[model samples]
Target: MTHYDGWFMLAAILAAFAANEVWRVVGVALSARLHEDSAVFSWVKMVATALVAGLVAKLVLNPTGGLALAPLWLRLGSVAFGVAAYALGRRSLALGVAAAAATLMVGTAVIAPGAPP
Candidate 1:
């Protein structure tokens, strides 16, 4: 690639990183001023939680390639099992991840026997 192309790509990545860091710094500053019990904090937490939930739903519904080739119902079922595991495991991240992985494997085996590697 040309030197200009390399510099352009570097500048793009740096810009993205700087944008994310700006949010982090703002959050840190705002957090210092706001108590956790404040209504604004609670609303922010809810919005963050909802955004995460939406992202998870999107991934489960339409995976990239590995799991996307599997049946839709299988993916949905695995996500449901994962959510249940997360709730039942007292919201433990590790246990929830394990359950989701296990369920995905089983679902893939049963639902997409001829899926390509």
Candidate 2:
């Protein structure tokens, strides 16, 4: 006996959309009244920054798939190398992401699993 069918899936999708959109609508309404330099805005900025940093730390510490094949120190060192490339390249966003991805792929090839580092 299955608990879910097409109608159930439709309801789940609609409910997910509603749940996601409600907050977006609220944020849109709130955005109009918020000043860019206000305390609330600063708090929001700090929260956003912290969330990004946490995500990056998580990725570096606990990677998945191909990234998981590389050792932890190499993963972290590649991130540092990418950040250095980004800063030295005038803080280009593309440069940073590309450098990090390339370093990971190449580093993985050089010191792949079942081989010495």
Candidate 3:
């Protein structure tokens, strides 16, 4: 590798750290005055939730890498299984996620025996 590559990588790391650090500091400063019950906080929470939901939907519908190898039915079914587990397990996030992962693994194994383990 060229000598300049190390300096470029260092610069990229510093830039990323600075970009993230600024937002973290800003968040910390704002968080002190924000109340969980306040409208602003609620709005922020709703937006964050919406973004996460959108991301999940996108990933499930149009997956990448190894996940893309799995059938669409299996992907969609895993989501359903996860949601059902979440509701049935008293809204336990951990249980829901675990159930979804297990479903995907078993389903993939059963349907595509040649798939990488």
Candidate 4:
């Protein structure tokens, strides 16, 4: 490849990073004045939580790559178990995440239709 091609790729990567960081810069600028008890902060928290939940739902419903190998029901069941673990484990997020991962592993081991007999 030509040297120009490398420069072009670097420029594209820089452009992508700049685009992604614009919001981060804005958030940092505004966060200094934001209070946790304020309505705006509450709204932001809600939106952020909803966005994460939506992302997780999307991954479970329409997984890509290796996750696609697991059935949707298994993924959903794992998420349910994780949530229960989170509640029962005194809100320990790590426990919840571990439970979800363990559930997925066990489900794959036991019910993988394509596994060798």
The lDDT per prediction is 0.85, 0.88, 0.95, 0.92
lDDT of 1 by residue, 6-94 (tens): 99999999999999999999988987999889999899999999998899888878779686776778778777788899999999878
lDDT for residue 53 in candidate 2, whole number 0-100? 86
Best by lDDT: 3
| Winner by lDDT between candidate 4 and candidate 1 | 4
lDDT of 3 by residue, 1-117 (tens): 788999999999999999999999999998999998999999999999999899989999999999998999999999999999999999999999999999999999999898678
lDDT string for model 4 (1-117, tens) is: 899999999999999999989989998998899999999989989999999999999999999987888898899999999999999999999999999999998888788757743
Q: Please, what are the lDDT tens digits per residue for candidate 2 over residues 1-117?
A: 256687798899999999999999999999999999999999999999899889999999998866677899889988998899899999997999899889887888778556544
Off by over 4 Å in 1: 60-68
Candidate 2: global Cα-lDDT?
A: 0.88
Quote model 3's TM-score. 0.86
Better of 1 and 3 by TM-score: 3
Ten consecutive residues with minimal summed lDDT in candidate 4? 108-117
* Ten-residue region with minimum lDDT total, candidate 1: 108-117
- The better candidate by TM-score, 3 or 4, is 3
Order of candidate numbers by TM-score, starting with the best: 3, 2, 4, 1
Question: What TM-score does structure 4 among the candidates reach?
Answer: 0.76
